[model samples]
Target: MQLGTFSFVTKLAGFEYTKFVRYDDEGDLRVIKAENAGPHGFKTTNYSRVRSSSVAELTRSRLHGGELLMVFVGAGTGNVATVPEGKDFFLGPNIGMMRVETDTVSPRFVELFLRSSVGKALATAAMKAVAQPSLSMGTIRQIPVLLPPAEEQQEILRLVEQALTAAAECGADVREQQSSADILRQSILAAAFRGELA
Candidate 1:
């Protein structure tokens, strides 16, 4: 399979918020900004939205699941997130979309790779050397992706999923221990304050 830009993705574009579009608090569609692209996934809290009717013209920018959302500019440049399936979200400004083109390659694998250290280093090197250090569509298109066989890619994804699940469980255990320590410390402080620490 061709590994060029067009081989993996059909669409590589950025959306811009225009003055003509108005944000609505009660809108059904959510606009995902850079801040929404969190470490785990897209965070929906406090996101801006436009009425579905108002953004009919921008339906092209609407995410249809598994689209890799990349922050092409600003401090968080190179950050990537995948749009969850069935989410009613539109690509907000400063973020670019890579709509996977081929079924041979899994979008989840690509997203995971892009968020990896090696992948991030590749993206970092592709950034413009100007004052702003933004990644243009042309540059993003040129970023090389390591494509293994389909089975291998799936295996890698499975391994990564297991690692993440283990990490999350470890994190939860640490938090629980910290909470217990905090309670013990508080109890000790209370006892000392009440002159019961003899």
Candidate 2:
């Protein structure tokens, strides 16, 4: 199913409509703006919250888990993310959210697809701009989604995540090994210069 076939909404721009409030102490509403959602993905630790004070804000701007977030405008034109679990965030400017309404469509799969090279290419092709690049809600709603069955989607997501984790671990190991090798080389040079190689 197309992503927006479920439900979609852009972040509101009513400054006056929002009450200046922070969840830093009370922990109610958290705002995930475009800046918080980078091209890499959404980070759980950025800790930026909404500008709304009244609980009525939840009636519209509330973001549930498992929605695919996309950077619809500006420099981050193609950035996408699956909202992490444990907390819900309020969507902010230059961002779009597609909350999957059916068990048939996997949100994780959609997020990964949008981040893939093919998906990025499609988004770039649809992009239009004068000063800043942007993808209209229509463009996103019509995105050609590859729907494997739910089980296949889960398996693919699991395997891809595992592979990515292994790759990251290998990279860290390589960096650590290289750093030790550099130190050893420097030590060998210092010993030779001091005629301690004997």
Candidate 3:
């Protein structure tokens, strides 16, 4: 099915009001700020826990797997990330999650599309100028997306995964080479200081 066949949210996901309950005796929930939120989808090796006294605090939008979380209204506006395996995280108010209908569209394909330059362009244009440039739900919903057949979508996803795997290996090799260069430089410096090389 095509992307246009799916329904779009009139408002940004997680903009609704909800109740929050404090989880801890200490006021740790109040200290849980948006700064602790990480950029969606950029797989990083490290993550810091968001301290909160309350487990039921409704500060951000709840997210599920197979959803696209876009930074709509923040310093990271226009940045897009897909939810990885499981669900059980909240998105800061600055972020908006796009839940595509799995029946109509392929989530994996849509994610790869959003990560493309064309998708970035659309998101960039949708951003509104404010204290911090933000994107309105209406603007995001209006962004045109091209959808292909389901079979085509699956093939595309397979190709993308293969490409990403190769890219990651190349990046690792580059990092190893850089580390080797650094070690050689350190050895030369130590030898020169010790008068081992005349």
Candidate 4:
């Protein structure tokens, strides 16, 4: 199903708020900017501190679980990824979060589409670079979406989740093997230095 810009979807779904919810820059809340996002997703290694004064700022664009967070209005504009579950986080000025109206659109389906080549092309086209390439809410709202049936969306999400879980497990295994290799290398080096290899 061909759907017009994001605004159309929001309006169709009766999303009452058009404004993004802004969070306060305070407490131990981790502020994730465009820079903190890796190609895969949100990078947590380094984060900025939220100021007490900046707390309570709400953006209708506030990210929650199952939302697709796109890096709009920033240097990293066009970078898109889904926010993983269980992470209470907020986006800075450089990012925009799209909350899919579950009744009308599947967040998982949107996430998959955004990661697709077609979505990438749309993003590239929408992005404007003067000093910094940034995407405005209007630009985002203008991008078209293929709206699949609700059941199809749910099935797609389940498949995607399963695949992601498998991929993560594979990554963990690789890391374990790498760690073992490192340990073995260190042991061999020590043994050789002690003339055990001779």
Index of the highest-lDDT prediction: 1
Model 2 lDDT tens row, 112-194: 87788987787667788568998888888877777788899999999989988999999999999999999999999999999
> Which pairs of residues collide in candidate 2?
none
Deviation in Å, model 3, residue 59 alpha carbon: 13
Q: Candidate 4's residue-wise lDDT over 83-138, tens digit each?
A: 66776555555666666644767766776776678876876685775887776666
Models, CA RMSD each: 2.6, 3.1, 4.8, 5.8
After superposition, candidate 3 runs with Cα above 4 Å error: 1-61
Per-model TM values vs. the true structure: 0.89, 0.80, 0.74, 0.70
lDDT of 1 by residue, 1-198 (tens): 222453333232433355335788988888878786666655667888878787677656777777877788887888888888887787777777887777778888877887889888887796877877688766777777888988999999999999999999999999999999999999999999999999
Higher-ranked by lDDT: 1 or 4: 1
How far residue 88's Cα lies from its native spot in candidate 1, in Å, is: 1.6
Q: Who is ahead in lDDT, 3 or 4?
A: 4
Candidate 2 Cα misplacement greater than 4 A, ranges: 7-9, 13-27, 185-198
Error of 1 at 178 (Å): 0.3
Q: Across residues 36-141, which tens digit of lDDT does each residue of candidate 3 receive?
A: 3244354533233333434344434445455566666667676666655553454445556667865757766776676688867765775676798887766777
Return the candidate ranking by lDDT, descending.
1, 2, 4, 3
TM-score sort, best first: 1, 2, 3, 4
User: Scored by CA lDDT, what does every candidate get?
Assistant: 0.76, 0.74, 0.58, 0.62
Worst-scoring 10-residue span by lDDT in model 2:
16-25
Q: Which candidate achieves the best TM-score against the true structure?
A: 1
Residue 134 of model 4 has an lDDT of 74
Global local distance difference test of model 2: 0.74
TM-score, candidate 1, is 0.89
Instruction: Please list all clashing residue pairs in model 3, or write none if there are none.
Output: 23-53, 23-54, 24-53, 29-53
